[model samples]
Target: MSAFSRFTPLIRALPSTVPFVGPEAIERQRNLPVKARIGANESGFGPAPSVLAAIRARAGETWKYNDPENHDLKQALAVHLGIRADNIAIGEGIDSLLGLIVRLVIDPGSVVVTSFGAYPTFNFHANGFGCRLATVPYAGDREDLNALLDAVKREDATLVYFANPDNPMGSWWEADDIVAFTRALPETCLMILDEAYCETGPASAMPSMQALIEQPNVIRTRTFSKAYGLAGSRVGYAIGTPGTVQAFDKIRHHFGMNRIGMVAAQAALADQAYLHAVVGKIKKARERIAAIAADNGLLALPSATNFVAIDCGGDGVRARAVVDGLMQHGVFIRMPGVAPLNRCIRISVGPEHDLDLLAEALPQVLKAL
Candidate 1:
């Protein structure tokens, strides 16, 4: 079974791993159907009717490859954000864009800075590119802004990944603080400000587009995957100065975006009213998730995203047991991957019936535990 072995040394040295073990894989491995299906932070509220209509309307165009330039989506985003089309770079999702960003700046052994337990996809991309990762531990369940800045300076890191309304913990800093952080970063160091959950967070937590759009060193990434209910579609974009974003054009896959997905994202952006309605539903679901945690005598950490991290009142072992117990009842959920943070099981907000399944299963899981 031996085959050609001319792969790069970095590729040969890497272990094969998925950043997140998806719920589908869990179902196949455990032989259990997922009743709630809220483990991966997808919007159970679903996309706007308008978005679906757009998809249906454009399904006939599936044979055509999406514009390599991503012109329509970029133009729509430009009008929406009040920025020029040149200021935006489109990608399949923030995950895809992270890889491209790494390729743009990181050489083998180049240092990349990030939070210790933040989003894992960015970390996966950094590793894939053979960059060294410098991680800063969370300070009080939030990314330590000061420590991240310090690490970037000390290492003169090639790239830094930071998430606003961060995942796993669902914590965030105010927009003003984020602006200050961006201002303090050295121009030579590139910063990726991931705002995937921005639509679900407080308005005060999101920095205005004008604040950092002009900074060539800063790239703010947002996605349709969260509040807009388009996780499967995988449409996201990066905002930065013209010179900065144009870098993507050099190496990006021409015509990489899906036609239907592009249509879905464009429709999602145009229907602001629908977006607001879905956001309201998401807010209520977050509250219900928190309430379910409270009912089980666990503390639901303060959340600014579509999910809540409920402290299970014990160590990783206890939290893991609860997660396993719930899955046994077809109530799929997740927990953080690292210590301290793994004490909490992360639950994505779903419709009432999904929460109903959770509400029914959680107590029994705890009682058994």
Candidate 2:
């Protein structure tokens, strides 16, 4: 594999990697069709009927670029969150925002802190910027906030990332603890408080909009993907002080927000009743998944998020076997990437049919193992 002759040192030195492997890629590699699409944390229930109607109505209007200022969507969000429109900066998604944040604060070798197996996308951005990463291991299947705080201070980190109602393990910390953690952080370090799963978590797990709004160093990122069923829309927003939010203008793709996606998010926000209904369905699905796991003699970890992590009663190898076994039965699923955390497998909440497939396949796969 011959590389480009004159690439920058940073580009040449960095390893090429994809943070996630979508189920479609697996199907292509194996020459198999996906029977139950439950591997990704996508809402199988999908966006609200109102949202679909909005998209259909606006399909012909896709010719125009979205408002680069994102005026109307920010106004709707401000009313919903009870925050000023000036506090919001809309982006393509949280992934894009993560990269922008890294660009803002990180120089080569700057320290960025996060949990060991926390969202890998944040780690991907850190690596791309040649930032030093300090990771704290999860304590008993949950992000050890105290250990993370310790690592941040010890490294004199410039940036820190924390996700409430986290991914993979699906654990969470209370709102007050998160607020306390923010206050305790040194003013010099900026915190990227990623709240991708906030709507699915308990109310106590989410801090109020007013909680850390005054701090210029604290930027909280939220997405329309998880509960709103807008993962494909790629619409997300960051809440921060006006001056801090303005910093995104320096590097963000001003016209990156697509017209259809913006309208979908706007409709999704207005349909709060639909969101509540789908959340109820998600809770029921979570319960069903736990029941299925329990029946098959696996332990389901407590989750404030939409997915559940199951302790597979062994090491990473055992967890890996389970994931592969499920795939063989056309039940696509995923597990953690590293050890300790990799001792568990992650199952996203999906429709009843998907759950039924998992339930039917588990015992057969275990017996084969």
* Candidate 1 C-alpha lDDT tens digits along 1-369: 795789899998888888899888899999999999899999998999999998998899999999899999999999999999999999999999999999999999999999987888888899999999999999999999999999999999989999999998999999999999999999999999999999999999999999998889999999999999999998999999999999999999888998999999999999999989888998899899999899889999999999999999889999999999999999889998887899999999999999999999999999998
Q: What is the TM-score (0 to 1) of candidate 2?
A: 0.98
lDDT of 1: 0.93
Question: How many clashes (backbone N, Cα, C below 3 Å) per candidate?
Answer: 0, 0
Candidate 2 error regions (>4 Å): none
Q: Highest lDDT, which number?
A: 1
TM-score of each: 0.99, 0.98
Clash pairs, candidate 1, are none
Candidate 2, poorest ten consecutive residues by summed lDDT: 31-40
